[model samples]
Target: MTADGGPDGAEPETNTGVLLFLPYRALENRVFAALAEAGFDDFTPAQARVLQRIGPHGTRLTDLAEQAQVTKQTAGFLVDQLEKAGYVRRVPDPTDRRARLVCGAEKAWAAKEVADGVVAQVEKEWAEHLGKRRMRQLREALTSLREITDPWA
Candidate 1:
């Protein structure tokens, strides 16, 4: 669809940015669907948030909880489920054996690698339509919006 054409041929600028945001939500849905089709559908969005925080370096459950904005108990419960699903594991922290580090399992790691490629391909396709400069500007605007909306950090 042409950006200038609204839902029914009217100009979208007459309204707010709802038209722009609707397409963005649709894009997110498509990306999520792609990941699910690739076998990463077992986790909830909250679980995905937790897993994203763990990453390659790994992170403490408490830290993940803080970053995910969930209580420690809630984070622990999510981690437990993820562990049982073979997406994550808790290993002893070398610096502090008393604490455990949350890490991605083999399946989760592979999914992340695949998802990275999928996202890059999606962005490249979008860049061809929106231009690289607009895409970069969109990224900056989204980052700023997140910071503004999420007061807790």
Candidate 2:
């Protein structure tokens, strides 16, 4: 180990957590850039975190909060902002009259389209770099890891 924690003096980021976070951060940045380019730049990362968990039909505030690992109040606040921005709407939960579900608006779906395209493109680039076999293996490994890493999974 040298002064930089490696013989080559590379920054010390060999840990599993950092390695996993790097590509995720890159994908996130690319998605946000594409979203901004597509005229959907009013949201923040924290808000997007909560928004990503909303189901196809809808999701309860409590559920969103739990899935996003945030407090109900925080989720509510983020949802409020999303509502103001026309990205989401609250509706009766049908099964429970007293409960409401957060449903994605058309604007939110539009943003999702842009994000999905970027994600697909990024995956293609990653696959090109890593080769199909290695990339498929990588994805399989990550998906297997998600069983332990993701609470909802």
Candidate 3:
């Protein structure tokens, strides 16, 4: 209805930002559902967001808070919950004795395996629907976009 052809000049479906988020939301839903079914049902999305940022060698609490875009206290609370659930453990950082690193436990890894399978299944379905070429292009575009949007990426 606008001169540019957007409804009230607001881009909805055709908005690049909205388009980019749709697939991610869908994938996240699938992963969480799969995780629940696999008996790793104690995790909240907030806790998982922090858990996902833990590096292989473990990561500092401050870093996880920064990467997950949460306050330090909030991150600490989530990490404490994760620790109680047996999904993560805190250990002294090798590089810094005064600091601690959060590391994923075997339980977390098992849940991640389930989540990974779900993601792979979703990606395959997307490739089938979008065609492999479009899927690849979409991935590449997102990765390129991360260079700007994601500080850690």
Candidate 4:
């Protein structure tokens, strides 16, 4: 078990948790945990990726695929999975019937609220620990680190 009570009482004996932990990784795990608690068990990571790319106004399937960095067929499969889960729908574009817009379902929006609450709680805890100025500094530092670590990003 680690110091965060991840399992048994045994704790990791160093500062490795903060040093090695990636914030994005932690957020992803938290989001999935919140989604499970919210009774959204049907959606997969791939499906979620597609839905996220769709955004609030909806997006073309091709754009979603590009944003997801996946092949068009793979994005279509992900969209299909999301549609099957009742979390998203594909509708004909009013401007262009030939293209479809992937939109989030009402239930998906509700589940998103739950996920947002979880993230807010996590953020609150982190802010309390780091304080406003320190948190801002950390964000700036991380931004710089990201530029250095992933120039293409």
Error of 2 at 82 (Å): 0.2
Q: Assess the local accuracy of residue 153 in candidate 3 as a C-alpha lDDT between 0 and 100.
A: 76
Clashes of each: 0, 0, 0, 0
lDDT of 2 by residue, 1-153 (tens): 223465566676567776788899999999999999988889999999988988999999999999998899999999999999999999998899989999999988889989999999999999999999999999999999999989888
Candidate 1 local lDDT, 11-81, one digit each (tens):
55534466567766766676678789987888887777788778587889988898888999999999999
> Candidate 2, which ten residues in sequence have the lowest lDDT sum?
1-10
Q: After superposing candidate 2, which stretches have Cα over 4 Å from the reference?
A: 1-13
For candidate 4, list the clashing residue pairs, or say none: none
How far in Å is the alpha carbon of 115 misplaced in model 4? 0.9
Error of 1 at 47 (Å): 1.4
Cα displacement (angstroms), candidate 2, residue 11, comes to 9.1
> Could you give candidate 4's per-residue lDDT for residues 40-74 as a string of tens digits?
88888878777766689888898888878889999
Candidate 2 positional error at 63, Å = 0.9
Output the TM-score of candidate 3. Answer: 0.90
Q: Cα RMSDs of all predictions?
A: 5.5, 3.2, 3.0, 6.5
Please, what is the TM-score per model? 0.73, 0.91, 0.90, 0.75
Best by lDDT: 2
